[model samples]
Target: MKDVLMNERHMLSRRKMLGGAGAISAAVAAASVSKVAMAALPEPVIQTKPDTMPPLVPNTGRPYNPVVTLNGWTLPWRMNNGVKEFHLVAEPVVREMSPGFKAHLWGYNGQSPGPTIEVVEGDRVRLFVTNKLGELTSIHWHGQRLPNGMDGVTGLNQPGIPPGKTYVYEFVARRPGTFMYHPHADEMVQMAMGMMGFWITHPKGKHPLIDEVDRDFCFLLNAYDIDPGAATPKIMTMLDFNLWSWNSRIFPGIDPLVVRHMDKVRIRVGNLTMTNHPIHLHGHEFLITGTDGGPTPKSTRQYEVTADIAVGQMRQMDFLADEEGDWAFHCHKSHHTMNAMGHDVPTMIGVDHRGVAKQITKLIPDYMVMGERGMKDMTEMEMPLPDNTAAMMAGTGPFGAVGMGGMFSVVKVRKDQKRGDYSDPGWYQHPPGTVAYEFTGALPDPARFKADVSPGPGSMPSMAKPAQDVEVKVRKPAGGHSGH
Candidate 1:
């Protein structure tokens, strides 16, 4: 079933390159293979240096992490007596991916997506928002719980955060965990346009409840709507708002979600689009310890191989990295993998027509024929070869191995952990380990915000039920580390 389409051509090329009068000896071949095995996978992509930019301004004195002081009443505020307002604005902006195709998106901070807001559990949160766009707006504290009056609803709980005027949302932070805040006013228009961010809540304790852990990381999932060509922007209709992304855009092959070897990574994934994404990673399953609110009941904690993160939902999961390799993490939706406005073209090497086109052709050749003639001619009996970059990264063939069905990503688990024993909790330790690494990437540098950032309140006022008495215990793999 694992048919190699052009294996002969590749083999011939390999033989020609490795053979002849200057052929490599057996020892050299063995050495090369060993070296290849030992070498680390390529690093995930980094920030691109903008070619055109404003002149640099001299640095002003500032701290590594800036803080803004807020004067709160020393007296405790009652949840029953007061209501607060929070306003969120949704607007479309063009980001320069390239002149040919700027990223057309809707954002809350006047850009695609919005800013992250972290608050302490039990803190009173009042969100005041003013919408400047033509369409109406409202903010739904997704996965958050407070009084029902503060729920951002266009018609149900309160009026929409109307255009030109401010809307206030006052609520008390009860439970704590990672969550999201986005527009619920006109989901089709608002989510498509951007208007979302992380609403994190920190537990009152200084350290994690567990004794051995080190750090935490948070990730936001999103899909973008971008049209490759045609200067005019593409409007997101209810049916065809077709761009998908995690964080913000399609991650280039080289630039992907990453984690260090032998590290503990906590990922908080939120889905705001109309679609659901069954997020999957190659190599291992992750522990689902937390949900929209706080930690799940110990008895009900899940280790998910493929978690379904649906629209208007959020999930918190963690995993340890015991193997070292580049991991490709992405949405399992067949349509979400679409890049560059759903053009169905491969990222071929060296074809620089547009930034997207050139990247596609150069980096991922398998997709070169996606929209080509007869490409869509497959009958129900015909299953085409998998051409996704993620599949290649996972080294799996279509219909022949794992990483198929659009549910795959690279998760580099370091090889430093003891093979026969996975008992150590070293992976979650702080600094360069799990906790610091995951949160560091998302938390803005001091330069971005002049305010304190920490976790905040989020949970539905309507909880399934108060979790009854549950036992807590350390978890172990069923077979007790088979060293597989």
Candidate 2:
């Protein structure tokens, strides 16, 4: 029923690429299919790259706008006798948090946070999950209303899928909204190992609340507790995660959101971490149009520049990209923008470490002093880092190195960008008279006063002002009242 007039050619191209997909009936899924019997199960397509795949346009069902996953991809489904079927394989994966840095984690297919699963509101959908992990696992579809048996909770709704077994889930997407899926059994270690995914249920036909947008983007907020130079996450750490990432990727690795000038854009964000994130966008204000509950009432919507998303929550924001520039879009938390090595470093501001460096270098030849002024020097200095560790900050712009990392990216709004073209259109060129320039005039230095009080030799100078000595003078009252 996807009768969208536009993108017919692209949809044809997409359908031809994946239209060969077909899976066995529900009864066949009751028995676990071995490697030799792969022909009886749906083909498990795996993606290892951290780049975003092309949006999957619906080729066989109700038409709707497809969401572009940042550093992720949507899972492809096969239309089988009016029921949409998808195959998910749970296994170990090596995810690249940044260039040349990888994390040993467990995920679906070949990436952490898994591939997104998109479906229409009224379509009958079927999911085939194959567990290749060491222990039992099951998936709970968050914010979804389905049959109790199909709810996917271990021991509550059904038994957990054992290792080397496959399970089938069939249901109709009763409501339309943004949702998520993760394991309910051993979720603490599994989610810490990065097992999660995004879900979207598009409303059928023209709904009264939803509107058309030029670009729709989606991603998840997740964190990790991997130590420096390590390749695996510490699954027991709850409050002190070292890496804050979007879709299991740090900034300079996450792709930018590019849109045409004046185009309407909708961004959906899901937080899976333990802490809250205040997502702030520069140079534009937006309205939160939707959440996990569904589309918000028009009367309650308000324009805001930052929306704080709590744990296990989703926030959808809509705005018009009228300004043409490369604007910042990131979390407002300062520490969340740093890499693994950025945290736990002691502050040495205003304390000259030169004296300490000379004393330490006598005993150890390789002792180096740092942070005497601030951490900005770390972005410039070529310090020796350990193996398999990400830089504290990376990414070079037209001016110089962009001193940022983790959960940071630019929203590049341009005028010449072609429709449906998602390639990164380089840096923005600012117009003259619009940018701030350094003044060429003269300036005065600050003044400081010398204290009158002085301590003994070899003592530091006191910064406090000296108190003035004054004489107390009293006058006799005209009328005496003390004796009376």
**Candidate of highest TM-score:** 2
The residue-level lDDT of candidate 2 at 228 comes to: 77
- List, residue by residue over 1-484, the lDDT tens digit for candidate 1: 0122112211211112123323323322332124222112111111122121111111221111111101000001112123211223345554432222345566653344454555556666655454556778878887788778777777887776545454556677777776777777877666666667667666645434321222244445655544434322344544444445554544332122344566666666777665677887766678777777567766776677778987767777677766454455766666555444333334333333455655777777543332323222212223333222112112222223332212233443445544322122222222354322234457655666436776468766764655786566544445332232
Q: Model 2 TM-score? A: 0.84
lDDT of 1: 0.46
What local lDDT does model 1 show for residue 288? 76
Off by over 4 Å in 1: 1-89, 95-101, 206-215, 230-236, 239-241, 253-255, 341-484
**Model 2, 333: alpha-carbon shift in Å?**
0.6
Q: Provide the TM-score for each candidate, comma-separated.
A: 0.53, 0.84
**For model 1, where is the 10-residue window of minimal lDDT?**
66-75
Residue-level lDDT of model 2, residues 311-357, one tens digit each, is 99999999999999999999999878878773445557778888878
